[model samples]
Target: MSTHPQSQRRLHAKGFYDEFPRKGGTASRATHYCAGCGHGLLHKLIAEAMHDFGLQDRAILISPVGCAVFGYYYFDCGNVQAAHGRAPAVGAALARCLPEAVVLSYQGDGDLGSIGLNQTLQAANRGERMAVFFVNNAVYGMTGGQMAPTTLAGQKTVTTPNGRDVETTGHPLHLCELINTLPAPVYIERCLLTTPANIQKARRAVRKAMEIQRDRRGYAFVEFLSPCPTNLHLSPLDAAKFVDEEMAREFPPGCLRDRTAEVAARPAPPPLEPLTPADIEAVLDKCVAVPAPPGLDPDFGTIRIKMAGFGGQGVLSYGMMVAGAGLADGRHVSWFPSYGPEQRGGTANCSAVISGSAIGSPVLSHLQVLVAFNQPALDRFARDVEADGLILYDSCLAEKPTTTTARALGVPASRLAIEAGLPKAANTAMLAALACSGACRVASERFSDMLAQTFAGKPALIAANRRVFAAATEWCQANLRPE
Candidate 1:
């Protein structure tokens, strides 16, 4: 054997996976980051600290949308991927939910400083029990080397071809200084990773941040002045020199705030309780009985309904009523709503599933009952109804549907509601038609109970809705066939 010890021959963090093959198939040992990038070094340091502290099992590494988005493939511990600039919020939630877990939020300059500035500030301001590692590479490395919020003044980037201009683009953001200004953060430090001495200091800072988190101390932020050689158009050695000579002058790596000694450990969170039927009943008010109507096909116990209309037409509420009726009748039910950008005068729709058995999917492409409140709504969703299904439309539509596969029924729902002195109850009139026409198996008493529960606060409108429901039921009974 060679004279060199096993440790001397090779070194790797126990907390890190054996290989980073996903980063590149060519080199199983190497990472995907560009040569001279600081992310690899930072990752090794953080992983080593976690391993040395015996926190590998209890650690949760949160990687957001950035150069390190694929960190889950490297770290052996519990990993959570987050949306761009959402790592801090995810880390805060994990820390709160699992008090014993050591949470780590790793993010780059663009993600933490720009789009996620508010989330970062809020998490720090609350003194969340976690550690945040901010890598300042002065450019968006992963997404085509764009100019980031922390890009140095006079620095040249793809967006800033000539150079970063202070007059047009603001100055480089100093995260340590900004976070230090806050009262909640316990420890805050800025360190460079270019030189050997600086690397030792950065390693110690990383350990200290993790140690603080282990003790349940409040927020600790460590800013690393990292390099992005590929984006900066510099060689690996030149990138280190640039960070040491030029970038360090602007950032000034040092401790901005240290309150670790003065702070106490946070209190442990309470244990979660198991959900009980009594708890469900207390929250849901009550559970009634479901009796299938006579006209429904006994072969299929599930009813998929879709309601589409203008935003002000109460399409969402109409679906909710069906779902609520199912819930009250002790059936499995789900309701989902979708709408356009504009709240009113815009198209809106919702899907609901009311079944005696378990609900597999909340979304339905083929609806058994479709209620369309407008011509556009009818045109958009009429084709999706099953061939043997029912299509109910408001009589106010200027153009009627041309679907020959499904049974089409046009009712004066809005006109009847206005006649009953409640123009806004058009949705209830359609629901009444659904109930009386035997399209839905729900009883009128259950619908009345749901309306009572829905308009409990607005008791005056409940009576008008009952009258509208009665009129629609009578009209459906007189004109519409049960089958």
Candidate 2:
């Protein structure tokens, strides 16, 4: 090796990998960004700061969905790639969980200023300890040249071919100005990346934000007005000139808020003590008020059930009861509910999964069982049942459902509930019908215990619901085949 002076030899930042293996190929030494994208420059500044502050091991960089999503390929520190516009939220989680670590949220204009605006503002408002690097290129760089929230008026993009219409699309969002209005942020600055002097200023701003993170100071936001040559249909030199002349006119670069000197460093959170199995059990028992039972047999397999009806029809309650029974039987269970805005008359549905083993997902596509309380529910979800699945509908409906794949049975659930003097217990009647059909492998004793636990406060209605359930069971046993 040539013995060159330390200052004369150029070296890569310590925070970055020696070679980007994720890029793969002979060009692994190069970045994936276009010729004049500002992401490369910003990445260099961040990596250098991480190296200088000795924060490489403690840094957790959150990369948002955009051109910079490949940040994990270069940054050697902890990296988390968030969904489109969710970097700030993910950063908040990391900041809370790993309070000792420095969290950085790197986002583009389209990702942060548009879809992630709420998460960004909320994190800043809550004074989350994280550095937010907002690269404002004024256009969506990843998914073609779309008009971003920060796109200036009259700026031409693929979505706005004839220049942006102020009347239809509104003016560009001034993110720095908006963030400055919030009180929790410790430091906020907007820097331009154009001329040599401006680039140096931006470098300082990036370092200052990292310093706040190093000190564990509250929210720090640094916005960079960067160039996007390919998207702007301009040469690299022209793009730099465009950012210096035109973009700077709209978004003047300067320190908007600086409380770093006034704010005290946040005290590190106390170390968390590990909890033993007995401690965890005690906590769960206290919180859930239920004792853990032995798990069901492996032969039980997995059962997917869906219940649907009007909002006030206790559809969600039916799913919960099924899930609770599964829990009491010592089986893995999941309940997912979906409903419309209107609480009473609107439609509602819920999916419940019971399995002898661990459950992968709660959402069911083709269900083993579908319980429909109304004609609309039957019409909507009847065809979703599997070939050997079972469909139980309220016999009170005026129309009969047509299905060739599954066995459809109509039970007088509403009439049975009314006869039992509990009109709202139709869902309980349907549950009883399901139990009698043997589609679910839960013990009958567990179902009874679940009912008692569900209605422990209402002593009067328990007997009535049990009557309704027994009537539904008898009707199903006599009329329907237990296929």
Candidate 3:
């Protein structure tokens, strides 16, 4: 099934989600990645676990930066692209949002050790109800060769061109030794992805992590000392040999923590008043704020939406604004985001599902409305809209396409936002038009309240955003003219 570079050009193309399997299959089959990159093997193991468990619908994956960033494009389950070092934070939120779903935090050396050190360790120590997978590739890839927290003493990377000098660069980070001190995790193991025999052993560790999730156990961690040939500028064979000879000696593989037996036999943590969403979701199947007075509408047909656009497009914050309004209206709400490259000039997006009953299966396919900021966004997702659905776009760009089944509207949102005094308020403008299409029953007052809360400290700028939403509403009413 393997093909040459020329034969797999489409697979290597940026934004190319190469494979689309019909059923239980290795969902990540597109392999244009540098040969011997341990990320590919790890991705296969994780995806296989997800599919084998038949928990695809009830699984939330938090994909970190580094080579693992594209984990979402192939996995059939729900995936969240997390900040470089904050996969654990997103994993914590996943446990809060869908308590029944299996949540996983996939991270790497530079991300977990350098930036996300605090988050990963804290999550493990406090026993955050999620599983975290650490990919310990001694050196950092993607961002050129650089000495990572786990880099061997003599390894040469762009940042450590003279090979890492222990005096200055210091020694490799032993995460297994570090996390072993935590009390609550169910299982912890270090596995190496060196050969077929070792790969099989890693598979057991992968299963153990998933089993912990299945049993509703607390925190679990598995760190894999992997290889990176592209960054090392070594051949596949040489890289694997390097991992065996150099990497394994510095950070040997084995279990670091396990409390599954104790956890199962021990009593549960005492319940407290639920203030945070995580506490609420953990305590109840669904969570909603105290209802408004009797006059307010008590029930609503929930509409789960996934919106995508360019970075700084406010895709996530705007979705939060809508989720906040849902709370104001006494409706149950949940907002999840995909970070990482989105924060770095790439496309950013989020999924918001407002519901009356408790929400289930957050994997969304047929949204009622699709919003596109650029042509690529539209081309990639426009077809996912349900029949008779609606599409909205920025008319200023020549990126929009004519939709037959769904009503498509292009609005001069950025220009209008500038007129409204919030020059970078295109997110609000675009969302207002989508709301007008009955995608979200957002009221002006509720939106104003969200605006106030969002800009809580910036009182001087409140009027500008207030006028902005009002203008967007007026424009929507004039054009959409919802009858």
TM-score of each: 0.57, 0.58, 0.54
**Candidate 1 error regions (>4 Å):** 1-11, 23-26, 274-483
Residue 259, candidate 2: Cα error in Å is: 0.9
> Lowest summed lDDT over 10 consecutive residues: which window, candidate 1?
291-300
Residue 175 lDDT in candidate 2: 95
Name model 2 segments beyond 4 Å from true.
1-11, 274-483
Give lDDT tens digits, candidate 3, residues 1-483. Answer: 448876565234322235643211563453434778887787778777766677677678887888777677766678899978988888887786666778988898999999999988888888887778889888777676688999888778888888889999788889988888777677889998889998998888887787778667778889987878878778888888888778888888877666677777323334444489877678786655776433234367767776777767788888798788878877777788865432124566677777776665666777876777666567766888777776788776536676547767787788779899898888778766665666676665676678788878988666777777779888888877562
Candidate 1 per-residue lDDT, tens place, 1-483, comes to: 344667632445677988776524555666666778899899989998999899999899998677887788889898999999998889988987787799999999989999899999999999888899999989988776889999888999999998899889999998989988899999999998888899999999999999998888889999999988888889989999989988899999998888888988666677556679989888778656566454323344899999999888888988898899878876778999987432114468999998877777899999998999888778788999999998999987625678648988888999999999999889989988777767777766777677887888999988889999999989988999878
TM-score of 1: 0.57
Give model 2's TM-score versus the native structure: 0.58
Residues 228-248, model 2: lDDT tens digits: 998899998999988998899
Looking at candidate 3, what is the lDDT of residue 307?
73
